[model samples]
Target: MSTPSRFKKDKEIIAEYESQVKEIRAQLVEQQKCLEQQTEMRVQLLQDLQDFFRKKSEIEMEYSRNLEKLAERFMAKTRSTKDHQQYKKDQNLLSPVNCWYLLLNQVRRESKDHATLSEIYLNNVIMRFMQISEDSTRMFKKSKEISFQLHEDLMKVLNELYTVMKTYHMYHAESISAESKLKEAEKQEEKQIGRSGDPVFHIRLEERHQRRSSVKKIEKMKEKRQAKYSENKLKSIKARNEYLLTLEATNASVFKYYIHDLSDLIDCCDLGYHASLNRALRTYLSAEYNLETSRHEGLDIIENAVDSLEPRSDKQRFMEMYPTAFCPPMKFEFQSHMGDEVCQVTAQQTVQAELMLRYQQLQSRLATLKIENEEVKKTTEATLQTIQDMVTIEDYDVSECFQHSRSTESVKSTVSETYLSKPSIAKRRANQQETEQFYFMKFREYLEGSNLITKLQAKHDLLQRTLGEGHRAEYMTTRPPNLPPKPQKHRKPRPRSQCSAKLFNGDLESFIKDSGQVIPLIVESCIRFINLYGLQHQGIFRVSGSQVEVNDIKNSFERGENPLADDQSNHDINSVAGVLKLYFRGLENPVFPKERFNDLISCIRIDNLYERALHIRKLLLTLPRSVLIVMRYLFAFLNHLSQYSDENMMDPYNLAICFGPTLMPVPDIQDQVSCQAHVNEIIKTIIIHHEAIFPDVKELDGPVYEKCMAGDDYCDSPYSEHGTLEEVDQDASTEPHTSEDV
Candidate 1:
């Protein structure tokens, strides 16, 4: 049991120590393998990244160069071309071309920024990754070397312990064998003495001597064997002691390798590699972030430049640059050739008669062409109808042929039907052909007639212009007769006859007399109501009130009852305004009478502000006394209303547009469309220059003056703030009057 235990213990100790060492070596090998693999992966990845960045840098640089070249090419082209240069100079920075330049520049800048980003990746981020990979690989190699050295050392210690253990076991077995031999020798010697002493065993002297010798030899051998056994035992003890010490040292070394050395090597390998990789990744991310931020900033600048473009300003700039090109052409004047007639009557009559004759001839030609064109048009339409009928019959024949083909009729029958249809089809086609020819001829006739008519119309217009010029020339040469003033017979006012007789369409003078106020009752009511409430109403006069409400209010005014007198809330402000506008529009005679419309409109054409105002004033004073008083009163109210233009959006211009035609309608004989704008301008001028145009009613010796002298409400005239009555009278007396109305 002891021997077996000894052998088993020695084998177990060696086997355990070898197994631990092998496991440690295997773990170190695995770590080294892992570190190598990671290093290889990192290197490959970094190489790939560097290659990508290098290519990206190249692309970005090339792109930037291309953008720069493109911009330069266009810019050079523009600079070299005369028209482009002129346009650039004219429009300056506000032009679309300038905006395009800015856009191109921004694009170039963006390209450059991308190039910079690429450079950053190539020079900084990629390089950093390369450094990290290189550093990690180097670290991996160093760590692997150290691990191998540690494992080797541990293996050496384990091998030495194994050798020592084997030697000890061998020595122990030898000692046991030597000890067994010594015991056997002693036992054999004892047995021989017993045999010799036995009676049955006779021994001679020689035999006795040999036996003694044998015994002696046996003892001596025993002694010798005992000595060998002692020596072997001592050797085995020494070997065992050596083996234990080696085993202890080997275990301690292996434990230290696993707990300290291996851990340190693995940590060193992984920490540096991971840290490098982390830094490289962070740098890459930061580079991308910075590139995006720069790109966004560039895009913002480009967008703002694009948004700032204005084509209208460009056109205006061009106009400013080339003023002479946009200037009006020189006006044409009549020129007399050499040897022109000196006789006034005959020469003028001859020119007039020739123009009249030419005009009449062009007119007659135009009439004949128009009649011919109409006849041709009718003939063409009739011919087109005949062609349509022919086409319809052809379509029916074609469909009938198609039906005959689809049916199971015999080929002979089909052919016969086709033959039978062919003739009629030909006849129809011939008819269609003739009808088409007739239609085309009529169309040609119509076109010719239209062209002739256009030519004759142009001739007629030219002749008319010539005749107009001749007449104008004659009128310019002749002096206008100073006709005596026609007597204006005053008519007696008629009393109101019926309730339906509206006050709005009545004579202004009759209404003024009936109201007994310089400003009519309706006008005063509307103005007062608007000034009180509707002053802040948006689009005061531009927005119309309900027709029903306006009519009702108008009837109330005509019934001699003030619909807007009290409880103003019952009447819509717009309705009251409508009533006022309706009254002015329905006037038998406008405030600026029709007779004076031309004179009033002409005043607006005067260039000088002071003279235009004086002209307007003179013309306004020529109005009948009742009309002039109402005009002054109405204009004063309008001027006051315009003061609140900000709230009502009814400045003098807007008010003028609303009341221009109402107060001074264009005459029937005049081109109302052409003169409407002039009428509005005159009204705007009167409203704006009311202080300068119309005198204060208090200064006037008329119905308004009597009312003002009585200290009436109308006495607070719009122009009363200008000067005293004496000053106004002096200024008025100095002014010239064309009629006794003033």
Candidate 2:
């Protein structure tokens, strides 16, 4: 016994197999469609992102431009008048104004970052997205085409299998028919032989011969039929074998398609598409992240500037700038009428009498104010109690009281009717309550007024007493002996310079000489610390340090102490940078002397790079030896800093913007405002071409130089001690005399 076939017929098997193939094809199509749809969506998403960033960048650019214009306009307006000079002198005002300027610059920087982000999205990110989408689409199409061809090939094989199966069935039916005919012919021949043996009918020799001939013909026919059956059977077996082989081949192809080929196609389409999308999205995210980081850095700079503003410092600066305006007025003297006879203004008796009288007046006023204050305090307490009682009345349960009244009304109907008839009574009660509340509020207001009056009286008394004491001190004291006025002697006034006690605001050359170094200790320490710790810190110089900390560090340097020698980990990088900036800003003569400001500006404006660099080198060589050496050291550090611009975001241009004014201050005049851009450009050019502008000198290198370069404690370098001062003086003598020299 054999197991029954699962399928009833070959047609059913073939139909089921074709159905599976169709399903697989449909699945492949669906997968391709899904991939295409995802690709389209990703492309659309990228496009939207691009548009968003572009518009955002436009907004940022416009906003930044407007802010820059606003700052420039205000700065111009301020610089056009004497107030600008006053602001420069007044440290308090200068700080906030500088902060405002810095704020505007930071915003402009952020806007530029946003604009850059927009450009990246449009030029780089979007282009990559488009390319990825194209590749994905192309891949999907190619996969789809391959899948369709594979399905077509499978269908052809299936069709051939069906044809083979049909031919096998035809041959099998012919063979069955031939075998039936042969069996029937053999049965007829048996029937004829039986009739001859039974003798049931007349048996002649001719009849027997006819019967034998019939039997012979039947046998011949049977033999021929048997031969045909055999032939049909062999053909049927051949057709069956062909059908089986075709079916097996088709099965293998289908199996391989479903297990390997289809999966590979799907993976190709899906994985590649997803991978490309992932990469594109990651790129966008990275760009966005960097943009936001830059924006935050800019904001931090603005915040630091705002935090460093000092109102007290500004006030002190105001006083310092306008000393005459803050001078004490002369003491008042008693003036007598021309016809009147009165004591001299310095008479002790008259002064004593006036002081006693003022003291009495203040004492009387103070007593009266005390009494009034007591009265107002009591009244205020009474008013507060009344208000509290009113609040309690408002919180009473009127509904419960009404129910009790109704219950009593039923018991005393005649009394209730009489009470209801007198509605004016209830109205009178409500009016009384309102009157009491009004009185309470009025009492509170009166108490407040009385308290205010008492306070004013007390203050008046205090002021009167103070004035009396001041007058007594002024007039009751013995006057100094009057002497004849000395004859006026005209003498030349001495020119003002920085105070000798502090390190800052002094001559840079003097400081260099004192320190016995080519670079000041403060500058060298700051640069070294920044290089060591701040290479990756964003917005190093742009962000301000704590004013208190900066001042502390500055004081340390001024006091001949190395503040940075202590644990550097606790030192803020911005604070060090701030100290450095302050050192430059406080120089009596900027690193680039004021006389050569125009020359430096002109050098930067030259069109040809080689010519500009040549002129810059010449101008730099003309600087005092100390100034030139320091500039070289500073510019070298700045150049090195700019190399890490990607991390610190302090490129040469940004650094120049921060340091330009400090190194080459514009004269406090209206004409130099337009030259500020050139000044910044000059500084930028120097920073970029520092090697060319300030070539290394062999004589400058020493143990101190190495120490400075290595971020060690500052020591006297060889240039300072090796007869360099005479050369510096000679260089200075050649330049036109400026106010700084005085």
Candidate 3:
């Protein structure tokens, strides 16, 4: 029996099998990997199912919340002016904490006692409860309304999504597809983890789809569905316009951003994304749920515009009059305390006046002293002839010393004066002359008539006098010196309806009740930034003129410049009145800063002030070029600025923004230099191919354009909106069916 008579049969061959352990181990490892793959697939499916069920639970919570609101009405009606505690009990049912507890408890019960720390069921339960919590967060504030029909509609969408998910696995002609993908992902994972052992830990995997045709069919099906959805969405938008407008207090921004971004509405008149969806839902809701689609929409734009002119139309009047409540924080008193304390420009003017007056006074006194000295000199001349032998007066050099002192005081002043002041005046005068000659482009709204201009000038002069005293920016000029200022019939200063400008002086009575009262410093800084970006346009969401109030006055000085600091006068008030020139003399293509802003555009052409101003004005008049330019410009500007700051090691304006995939979290000056060069080169190339787009914009002056391929290929989003050829190829590699709304 010694080892079965020492290897006789082929099956029992035991001539010291050479390392069959390694082969056996290899087979076991393969089997292990297969098991892991199946496990992962199951886990993924279960997770998806849980997410769907969680959504359903959320719908339940929403329905319950709505019921509570309905019950509140009933409770209020039934309380015959008595029984406070009972009424409180009814209200408690709606309390967010209680609602959340009930929702979670229901989930726990539904989970069949299988709840554990890592339990999928428990996680689902928790997710549903969290959604309910969001709804009940602040009773007075409305949560996202998930209506019954909407829930049903979302359920339908989930079913569709599941169908597509299932199709992915079945679509593969060969079962090896999922396996292949798993292998690929595992390979990537391995590369990342830096593991080189013979796969000691087998990863979970699933059957992979191997057929390319199956993938194409799935993609085609998805495209067909998406197209149908788009059509339905479009119909829904037109139908639900009224409904959307009605929810103005809530839906305005959402409606604009979500829809307009996805469509061409920014250029042509069209419906938004949600509106289209709502339209499709209209007939369905009306037919099935008896929902009135018309109930939600506010007055349409045309009606709103007409209503605005009607001062008595309580909505507009109430809003304008009560401005504080509409904004926020209701701290008018605090704002008043913070505003216009420095009034640098105004103060500087006062200082200039005082200095002038002092000089005049000194001149008069000096003249008198000279006359007295000369008279004394005449008499002394006769006396000096006799005293020449006695005194021997030495020659004096006082004049030279006085001149030297005067020149020294003005040394620092010269550079700023010559560069900033003289340049601005010469440039502005030229622009004014240009505007005077050209008439088609006058801001017709501001120019009523020549007579009005005269009156405006008179008012401006009076305004100047009021501002000149004590550096007070808040004070309106005392009523124009009425030389019976022949009021050739006052036409009312561009009725409050016309002027978009903010009140320079605080209308404390008006803004005291606003709910969104931002600090004056924040307001001022934002305004300055906006103004720096462009000044012709008023600020966004701003009620006050904090930025404008900060002028080239003595109080507004640089950090280490004591003389300027003590006085607060550095920037000239009118220096930046017109557009700044930006030239792009490069080789790429013409792109420029023009659109997507609600206000002043800073696009420039390196010459002519009014031309520059008019050019910028025309720029944002519409969404110019294409979405590509807009996306490119914004990305470049943000990335460049972010990188430039990083290189300098300065704190970022918004550090969280650096987390985006395309974001260079801490891009430095190197990125900036590279980006800048690329942009410049594009401009040059565009000039060469000037005939392509802006055929009229000749080679004499180049146009600004955003350049990607800068910053070491920032196109890493793996998706494409404004994309390069390489980026598009990468995007195509990701099957659209597998992608989410992101």
Tell me the lDDT of model 2 at 110: 50
Candidate 3: segments with Cα more than 4 A from true spot: 1-120, 127-550, 553-698, 702-742
Model-by-model lDDT, in order? 0.59, 0.56, 0.29
Ten residues in a row with the worst lDDT in model 2?
A: 486-495
> What lDDT score is found at residue 601 in candidate 3?
20
Task: Identify the superior model by lDDT, candidate 1 or candidate 2.
Answer: 1
Best by TM-score: 2
lDDT of 2 by residue, 577-614 (tens): 98898778877778888888877777755766556766
Q: Model 2, residue 324: what's the lDDT? A: 40
lDDT for 144 (candidate 3): 15
Top candidate by lDDT:
1
Give all TM-scores, in the order shown.
0.33, 0.35, 0.17
**509: Cα error in model 3, Å:** 41
